[model samples]
Target chain A: MITHRVSLFVAVVIACAFLLFDRAEATIFERARQAAADALSPVFEVVSGPVSAVRDFLADIQGYLAVHEENARLRMENAELLAAQAQARDLRRRNERFAALLNVQVDPTIEYATGRVVADDGGPFRRTLVVNVGNNDGIGRGQAVVDEHGLVGRIVGTGGHSARILLVTDLNSRVPVYVEPGRRRAILSGDNSDMLRLEYLESDDGLLPGYEVVTTGEGGLIPPGIPVGIVAGELNGIWRVRSQTSFDSIDFVRVLRFDFPQQIEIPPPSLPGQFIGVEVTPSDSEIITTPPATTDDEPARNESDDTNVAQPPSEEG
Target chain B: MEAGYRRGLGSRIARGPAIMVPVLVTLLCVVATVMPYGSLQGIPLAPMFPLAAIYFFVLTRPTLMTPLGIFAIGLTQDLITGGPIGLWILVYEAAFVVTSMQRVFFVGRPAGEAWLGFIFVVSLSAAIIWSLASMFYQTAIPLVPIIGQMMVTALVYPLLAWVFTFVLPEREGGA
Candidate 1:
C-alpha cells in the first residue's frame, strides 16, 4: 500500500514537471489539441447555436419590455452621432489634404474577417474564447480580435476552422497602450478581473481617471490607434482600464489583418533633393526630430513642440 | 447452438444497459461540462457535472470506475478546455485516489453520510485545483468561482446519485 501511494505521488510529480517544462506556446501537443478541437468544432457550433438563439430571444423580449426607454436613448444618441459624423468627415478631408501636401503614401488599409464566438474556457483559471473562423478564413495567430466597441483580444491558436482568442482580461495579456491627451505610454496587463492594470509607467507620472487609452503598436504586433479602454480607477498605484468591448455578450468578432513592415532602416541621401531636415524610419513614421542641433534650449523646446503639431513636409533619404 | 444456450445469450444481451450505463454516464458528464448552457452565461461557472458523476460512481460502483478511466476523462477535459495539459488530470486523479481509499467507508452508509462525504471530498478537490492552477499560472486565481463550483457540485450530488442508482439498480446479485 505504501508503495502504491509512493508510485502515485511520483506519477503526479512527473506529470506536473512535464507540463511545467513543456511551456512552449506552439508544441506538438498543442497542435494535436487544436486538431482535436477542429474535429469537434461542428458539435460545439451546433450546441451553441440554440443557446445563442435562446439568448437572443430573451434579449428581444427584454428589449420589448424596455422599448420606451430604449427609444428615447436611441433618439438622443442618433442626434449626437449625426453631429459627430459631420465633424469626422471634415477632419478626414483635412487629413487627406495634409497627406497629399506631405507626399505621404496612403495609410495601410486594414482588412477583417468576421466570426461567431462558439465556446469559452468555462473555468476560472483563464479567459479565452473559441471563434468559428480559423486559418481557413485568414485568421492567424497574433492578429487582433475586436468587437464593434473596441479591441477585445488576439488570436493565440488556430485550427483549420476554429481559433482561440486570448481575451485582454486574461492574466497573460499585455498590450502597449498610449494614454490620450497626454500620450503617456504604459503597458496594459490583465489579472483575470474586469479591469486591466496599467504597468511600466515612469515614476511620478500618473494618468487621470477616464483618460482614453489606445494601442500604441510599439511592438508592431497590434496596429496603432485601435481604441482599447479608459482609465476606470486606480488602486494602490495600479491604474485600472475599463475595456470598451464588453466580454459578456461577445457574439461576433472581427479579426484584423495587419502586416508589419519588414525593414525600418532609412537609406542615406542619394541627392540634394531627397535630403531634408527630417529623417523617417518605417517603424515609426509619425515621429520626426529636427536634423540640426540648436544650442539654445528654449528654441529647441519650441521647435520640438512645433514638430508635434505640424509635421514639416521635409523629404527624408 | 442449443436452445438453453441461446436463451442464456439473449439474457446476457438484454443486460447490455448494465454494462454500458456507467461508461455512457461518465462520457456524457464530460461532454456536458463543456456544453454551452445558458444558465452558465456569465461569471466563470465551470460545469461540475463530472464532479457529481465521479462522486456517484466512486461511492456506489468503485470497480466500474477504474483509475485509468478517470485519468482518460481528466485528460480529455484538459485537452478540450485548452488549459494546461496536466491540470485536470492532477485534480481528477487526486479526487479519485482519495475517494477510492475511503470507498469502503461509504458502503451501506445513509444518504446523509454520502452527501457529507461528497461535501468533504469536493472541498478538498476544489482546494487542490485552485492551488495547482494558481501555481501553473503563477498568480492566484480568485477563489469565488472555485468556491461557487464546489457549492454547486455538492448541492447537486444527491440528484446525480439518485439518477445514477435509478439508472443502474443495485440488484441482490450485483457486482
Candidate 2:
C-alpha cells in the first residue's frame, strides 16, 4: 500500500517538474518563483554575512601581512621589467606604425565598464559572481568580463543594481576560443572545474596539451586575444583551456561594457548610483597604495576628495 | 538552547521547542560556517549539517521531518550557495528516502551506531550528489575531493550527532 502511494506521488512530481521545464521562463509560476528569489536573496545575504566576515578575516589577514613581501618582489620584478620595457617599447612603436601603415581602422576597439565584485557565488555547480555595476551602470546582457590576468566570463543576467557573471568554470558557460599561435579554433567549455575543456577542434590543427587558448572573437561574446589559460592535461585526448584569471576567490572585478557590430560605449564616469559603491580606481598602480576599506555597513572606495588632486593634466611627452 | 540543554537529562527533544529550535538553528549555523564553495582548489570541510539533522529527525520522529520542509531548506542552501535550483532538492530526497527506509534499524541502537550509520549515509549521499552533479555538468569530475568531503563529513558525524542526541534525546515513551 505504501509503495503504491509512493509511486503515485513520484509520478505526479515528475509530471509537474516536466511541465515546469517545458514552459521555461515568462510563466506565472516562474515569475512568482523569481520574485520569491529576489525577495529572499537579501535575507540570504544577511544570513551569509557572518560566514563572509570570518572568511574575509582569514583570507585578508594572512594576505595583507604578506603583501609587503609580494610588493618587494614585485618592485624588483618591475625594475627588471623597466629594463626590458625599452626593448618592448621599440617593438610596440614599430608594431603600431606598421598597424598605422596597414590602415587598421577596424581593430576590435574594446570598450569596458569597470566594476567591482560584490559577492562570490562560489558553489560547486555554479561558478558566478555579483558585480556592483548593473543595468543602471550600462551593464547589459552578454558583455565579456576580464580581469588583469585574462578572461573571466560574460554577463548572463543583470539585476537593476548588480549583474551576475557566469565564470568560465560554470556548467552553462561556453566561449569560442582559438588555440593561439596555431590559429586553431575550438570551443572552450566549462564543466565546473578550474580548467575548461577545449571541444570541437579540428584534428588538423595539431593541438598539443600545453597549447595556449584565447578568445577567437568569433561570436563577439569575448574579445580576441584575452589570454584564456594554457591547455591543461588532456582527458581522453581532448585538451582543455585552464583560464588565466583565477576567479576562485576574487573579491573585486571589472565588467566590460562591450557590444558587437561596431560602436561600443564604455561606461562613463558617474555611472554608479547610491545602491552599490564601487571603487573606480583610475589606475591599477594605486591599488596597493590604498583602495579604501569597506565594511558591511558601507561599501569601500577611495574618497573622491582625497584622490582628485593626483591627476589633472599629464605632462605630455 | 532547548535542544542542546535537553539532550543531557530527562527531557524529550521532540516535545521541547527549546531543543528543536536551537538544533535547527545550530544545524543551519554549522552548515553555514564551514561551507565549501567555489572550485576544487578550496572546498571547505563538508560534514553537511542538514544531512545530519535530517537523519536525526527521521530516525527520531519521521512525522517531524516533512519532505516539503526539507525541500525548502535545501532550496535555501541552493540559492545561497549558487548551486542549480533543483539540485539539492533531489539530493535531499535521496537522503530522506534512504533514512526513512533504514530508520527502523536505528531505533534502540546506541548513539555510536547512529553515528556510524550517519557516516555511511553521508558518504552514500555525497556520492550520489557528486554523480548527479557530474551528470548534470556532463563531465567526469574528479572524485578525489568529493571523497575527501564525504570522509570529512563522516568524521564530523559523531560531533554533530552528539549535538542531535541532545535535541532528540531518545528514550522510551519520549514520543
Candidate 3:
C-alpha cells in the first residue's frame, strides 16, 4: 500500500513537471511528435479502413433514399450554372484584357498533392487531423489544405510519411480574409466551435449576413481568392463565419504547394552631373536650345526632378 | 494428496488470466477511443473508454493496474490525440488515486452502487482534464463538449462494466 501511494505521487509530480516545463516550440519535442506520427500513421490507416467503408456504405444508402429530391435540385442548379457560366466567360476575357493593360502580376497556378485523412484529434478541445501524405509528397508547414468544398485548414507539422493539419475551427487558427460586397477586411478567428468569429473588421457598413468571405492572401503563405466561408450571423454582437467545408464528410484533401515571389533590386540611374567623360560637341549647323530660367522656378524644377529620381530607392528599401 | 496437488495447479493457472485480461482490455479500449469514427465526429467528443476501463479494473482488481501502467496508457492517448503531453496522464492518475482510496465502499456492494460510484469518478476525471486543458491553452474552452462527453461516458459505463465482468474472476462468495 505504501509503495503504491509513493508511485502515484511520483507519477503525478513528473506529469506536472512535463506540463509546466515543456515548451511547444522545442525542436526536440516536435521531432519526437513527428516520429511518433510516422510510426503510428499506418496503424491509424488500418483501423480507419473498415470504419470509413462502413461510413461510405451508410452514405450511399442515404443518397439512394434522397435521389429523387437530389435530382430535382441538381437540375435547377444546372440551369442556373449554365447561365452563370456564359457570363463568367465574358467576364474572364474582360478581366484578362484589363490585367494585361494594367501589367498586374498574377499568382501562378497552384499545384497540390492529395492524401487521405487517417486520424482525427479525438479530443474535444483540439481540432486537428493526421493525413497520410508528408514531406515525402512535398507537403510542408503552412501549406493550405482543401477538400472539394473549400479551404479546410493548413499544414502545421510533417514527418516522412504523414502530416498534421490544424483545422480552421481550432482555437489557434486565425485567417486574414475579405468580406465581400464591401471588401471589409477581417481576421477569421476560431474559438474551438463549429462557426468562426470574424474579428478586426474596421467597419460594419455594407456588411450583411450571408456575405461571401474569401482569403485576401495578405500573408503569402495562403494564396488569394480561395473560398473560405460566408458570414453566417452575429453572436454576442460579434460576426461569425460558417465554413464551406463540412468537417464530418472530409476524407481526402489536397495540400497546395506554393512559394511566394521574391523581390528583385534594380540599380539606380546615374545623376546628370555624375556622368563620366561624356563631352557633348554640337554640330556646326545644329542649334542647342536652353530654357530661359526664372529665379522663382529654378529651385522648384530641380527639387521636383530630384524627388522623381529619389522615389524608386526609397520604395524598394 | 493427489486432489490437493490438482487444486494448487488450478489456482496457479487462474492467476495468469486474472492479471493479463484487464491490462489487455484496457489497452484495446485506448486504441478504440482514438480511432476515427466519422459518424461520431459531429458529436465533438469521443467516449473516454480507457478511463472507464481503468475505473472498472481498479475497483475489481486494484493490484493489476499500477500507476506506471496507467501513466503509459494516458501518454499513449495524449500522443495519439495530439494534445498536450501530460494532460491525460495527470487526469487518469488523479482518478486512479481517488478511486483506489475509495474502493472499499463499493467493493462488495450491488452493481447499482458500483455504477453510481463510477459516475462520480468520470465526473471528477472530466473536470480535471477540462481544467488542465483550459490552462494549457490559456483560454476557457467551451464547456458543452466536455459536459457532453462526461454524460456519454457515464451513461456507457454500465454496459462496459457488464462486459468487463465476463473477464473478471468470480468472487469466492459471489455478490
The chain B TM-scores of all candidates, as shown, are 0.81, 0.75, 0.83
Tens digit of lDDT per residue, candidate 3, span B1-175?
Answer: 8997687567647665755677778877876776665534345445788889999999998867889888888777777676777888998898898889779999889989888888898889878978998898788988776777778888889999898888876542232
What proportion of the real contacts between chains A and B does each prediction keep? Answer: 0.31, 0.12, 0.61
Which stretches of candidate 3 lie above 4 Å from their native place? A23-28, A57-91, A104-106, A263-317, B1-21, B39-42, B165-175
Worst 10 residues of 1 chain B by lDDT: B37-46
Best by TM-score: 3
Stronger candidate by lDDT (2 vs 3) = 3
Clashes of each: 0, 8, 0
Alpha-carbon interface RMSD for all candidates, in angstroms: 3.1, 5.2, 2.0
Question: Model 3 residue B118 lDDT?
Answer: 83
The lDDT of each candidate is 0.71, 0.59, 0.75
Q: Report the error of model 3 at residue B144, Å.
A: 0.9
Whichever of 1 and 3 has more DockQ, that candidate is 3
Which consecutive 10 residues in model 2 chain A have the weakest lDDT in total? Answer: A293-302
- Candidate 2: Cα lDDT at A56: 63
- Candidate 2 residue lDDT tens string, B9-126: 4444445664345336534643453232323363433356677777777787665565655666665555544445556666766777788878888888888888778777877887
Cα shift from native, residue A154, model 3 (Å) = 1.2
Ten-residue region with minimum lDDT total, candidate 2 chain B:
B31-40
lDDT of 2 at A64: 92
A best-first ranking of the candidates according to their TM-score comes to 3, 1, 2
